[model samples]
Target: MHIFVKGAAIAFFSLAITACSSNPDDGFTGKESADVLYSDARTAMETGNFAKAARTLEQLDSRFPFGAYKDQVQLDLIYAYYKQDSTADALANIDKFLKLNPTHPDIDYVIYMRGLVNMQADSYFLHDLLNIDRTDRDPQNAQEAFKDFNRLLKSYPNSKYAPDAQKRMQFLKDRLASYSVKVAEYYIKIDAWSAAAVRGQTIVETFSDTPYVERALEIMVQAYGELGQNTLKQHALEVMKTNFPNNALVSQR
Candidate 1:
């Protein structure tokens, strides 16, 4: 009887192991070739099925680390990650690709994509398209996008993406300067006149080309006036008038 029980237990254990090995939910064990996987991912992406594309690309990467389409796979992974709003993964994968293939012929495109990812991460769509200024926020992503765009322009002056990168870089700079102006305005509201004046002055010095310069100069005017700094106020007003003549702000003062 005991021998019969042991035999039955052994049979159950063996079947369990086999079942576990053959389980579909165990892990990724695709039998498809790398080319097929790549094609599927591409098709999914082209159809706006980004989630599936990201998953399939991830699996393809794992299945064929050194395949013929390895580099393109990495680039596609970045795009998939970006489309999925996975900014951390997108940036990380882009960095990985750059480190692995420093001399890649499409380095310009990679950098452009990097800038695009960061710009998207900035979440400035409303501000960029609608002109709805919301500058009282963090500018970390904008700063990163600015750096990436600037790097691309410097490295690939004649790149097809150069003009767009330059435009985006300018947008980021303007956004950052606008953020400083908002900070200054907040400081003014809290009666931190000195700090407000400093931010305003910094904007005028660093981002003179941005429209925020006008607002920043206005901040300086208000902040210095609050601090009873007549001379500095007059100086800022003169600068504002010189730069933005026919400005309603100067006329109001």
Candidate 2:
């Protein structure tokens, strides 16, 4: 009886050890350490394997949320998402970083990247491939990008990104002005003279420094004339003569 009991106890212990050793969850639970995972993620990024880098970084984030490299990992993840054209994810991460680390030394860079992501968010791949003019499409993304760049400049004027942000803002301003002009032209085509005049006036008031202002003035004159607002028409013509001296519209008037 004592020998049989001893054999049964040994068999039970062996079975327990086997079950523990063969558990899939145990293998999965033994994740790589934070340092090793971060190193691997960096290597993936350096190799331009952004997809792999993103996955690894996401895993590292989930496993070690408060690790020593937390801030840097978030920044790297943002870059990885941007490189992969995951605009929504990149923006979400950027917003989270900005909200959480408002005083981070690299906040200006984050803001600049936010602007860049928004700038490309609405870009049509096929349009670029075919050299198409899609400026007439909705400028919502461009407007958001413009606001972001403007915010960055206002908040961090001396940042390294300021110069590039300024250049992009100029581009956005011209694009916005052009979009307004297109809207004015469409209103005129539909014989909505009052609406066209309103759009033209908005362009003149808001985008006065843009090249589109000359066209906007022309639109104002045409729309006001069609609406029989002689005073407004003459006002637009006089402004055109003063600013655009040799404008074809002025000579026609």
- How many times do residue backbones clash in model 2? 0
| lDDT per residue as tens, model 1, 149-233 | 9999999999999999999888888889988887887898899999999999999999988888888888888889988999999
Model 1 poorest ten-residue lDDT run: 19-28
Q: Quantify all predictions' global Cα lDDT against the true fold.
A: 0.86, 0.89
lDDT of 1 at 49: 77
Q: Which ranges of candidate 1 are over 4 A from the true structure?
A: 1-29, 124-133, 248-253
Give a tens-digit lDDT track for model 2, residues 108-203.
999999998898886765466445799999999899999999999999999999999999998898899999999999999999999999999999
Worst 10 residues of 2 by lDDT: 20-29
Runs with alpha carbons beyond 4 Å of true place in candidate 2: 1-30
In TM-score terms, which candidate is top?
A: 2
Q: How big is the positional error of residue 9 in model 2, measured in Å on the Cα after superposition? A: 70
lDDT of 2 at 77: 93
